[model samples]
Target: MFTSREGVTLDSIAAPLRRWLLNPVLTVPAALVLSGFATATPNTDSIKFLVPVCALVLAGVLLSLNDYLDKQFANNWVSDNTWNWDEEIVVVTGGSVGIGASICDQLLARNSRTRIVVIDYAPLGWQPKQEETRLSYYQCDLSDSNALRSTCERIRSEVGHPTVLFNNAGLVRGVSIMDGSYGDIEATVRTNLIAPMLLAKEFLPEMVKRDHGHILHTGSLSCVTPPALIADYAATKAGLLALHKALQLELKNIHNAPRVRLTIGIFSFIRTALISGHTNVPNFLLPLLHVDTVGEAMVSAVYSGYGSTIYLPGFNRVASTLRGGPEWFFRILREATANFRINFRGRHEVDSQTGKILKA
Candidate 1:
């Protein structure tokens, strides 16, 4: 079969059918509805089919309107036409591996003229193709605040200012609060939370000055449904979500930069080395998302030139609604998912002073 960049197979009719079923636009079905109206016999069975089809159409319309309104308002009811892919310098944290790597690849595939700057502590996992001259890799440990600041300075001076920043680097210590060492806790917070904020501080001013840029944060579902054994990871994710929300407000109100798009992808468990040993029970309902599926979503949002709140797999938007629901329901949710164990296989010892890896 032929799998496209977005991971949708196009070799068969099933792919488009699946997309039509999932997409809120319902374009294919809408056409079918029109055809049905034109060819319908004046009978009771037609009425039955038409009633359900009309109901689905109505639901699709409402969902589509919600999406349109959200996109417009998130972007301050304005569209930015200033994006020049040829000149835009894109930055990605942890761009060496996992979802970060996926984002880099997807961006490169989408725009040949776009440049990508990858900031990661490790070396690039795969060799870049000979003709891929638009990509630049910078190695930097994001946990250390001083190191992070210096890296940002170098990125600006060396590679030019980044027009799009993907705060995608993150780590998780899959241990309980008490079991985790101080270095583990600190590294998790620094890498996952503080690094993104510091990076924003470095790049956001220029973006605000230009009144054009995009900041895409890869947050987690743990922000709302905090599971057991990964308290530190959950806490940092929760803080990241809160930071994104506040940053969105500050960008508009304080900085007067409504055109600086802020997007956060709140995803469930993804199939990556980061979540290596953590297995989801009844995995069918909470399947691990393909890294490309996420990367495509983030990159597409940036190209849209609008801010967005992306919930992966679409149904995860319920987490937002669940936040405002009764305490009892939330409590039940926590308890139910408590046993979804996280035995992170990549746990490594860190230096207490430096938060750098000591032992694997």
Candidate 2:
């Protein structure tokens, strides 16, 4: 609380102490210590002391799982490749907008030599930040496999093999199966699920040969708890999660390319154009995350060679495990918020911009 030059002040102590008390991680350990004292006291109920201690330990282990996984990946990947932002060529999918753009901003600013290539159909000419020559843009709709391959080949030829790949491109119509178009369905599945696999197919082998690389897949809360209305979106996300994990196993066990790090990001509702005009589950429980913050985290992990399945606003990690819990919990959450699907309002895609049920 006190600077060495200033010595301790009452005000300085209070603020630091208050923050320590408010921090759940620190507070839990403090409570456990107090519980230990209580259990030792005569006539004090042992259950009261034991209850919170058990909870603290359980939560600690669950959270440590991410750390353990990261440590394991680091041992394999970092030992071979190591983290060098300057030498690494980073390629981000869908970098023309939203979190992808944010990630590009961070990486470009992070190191002058780290080249960034953005693959997206959208024009990045509108982006003010991309004025710097450090970032390159390739116009290719990932849904078109031929266009995707051609673009990748061009990137490989021009930029060298990208050592880091951010599979962040994603889309959702926010409509039910009946309301969705065949074109839209194909686009959604291709963009969200198939494209990521394709990108991996294109880039992963190069990483394996070099014995160095990182792949961060942008998963969703939908992977754990599929919601109503956006069934296709949720399904694609679930498939992404499964396939991403399978890719990790195949890389490490089959190819013996332990140097390739895989990270999956399961984010809740993010404040981005993709989810614009949409509502989230009660903000009190799950707040809308800023794109910049999420992007920074993603960039930091890859740039620093950290690896793990990260849950943004990390409490969602515990929430995700609820799937294995009782049915009543699911029913209550579904009934309480109605899956955050209320904003859809039963509109079908009658046009490119607006949705309204047709005369039929």
The parts of candidate 2 lying over 4 Å away from their true place are: 1-66, 73-81, 125-133, 278-282, 337-360
Per-residue lDDT value at 71 in model 1: 82
Q: Whole-model Cα lDDT per candidate?
A: 0.79, 0.72
Clashing pairs in 1: none
Q: Which pairs clash in model 2? A: none
Looking at model 2, residue 345 earns an lDDT score of 28
lDDT of 1 by residue, 7-100 (tens): 4322233445445553545744764765576576654355556556666666666766887898887888888998999899999998988888
Among the numbered candidates, top TM-score falls to: 1
**In model 1, what lDDT does residue 44 have?**
37
lDDT of 2 by residue, 195-237 (tens): 9999999998999998788899888887776677778888899
Off by over 4 Å in 1: 1-44, 130-132, 278-280, 345-348
Look at candidate 1 and tell me the lDDT of residue 49: 62
Alpha carbon deviation, residue 274, candidate 2 (Å):
1.2
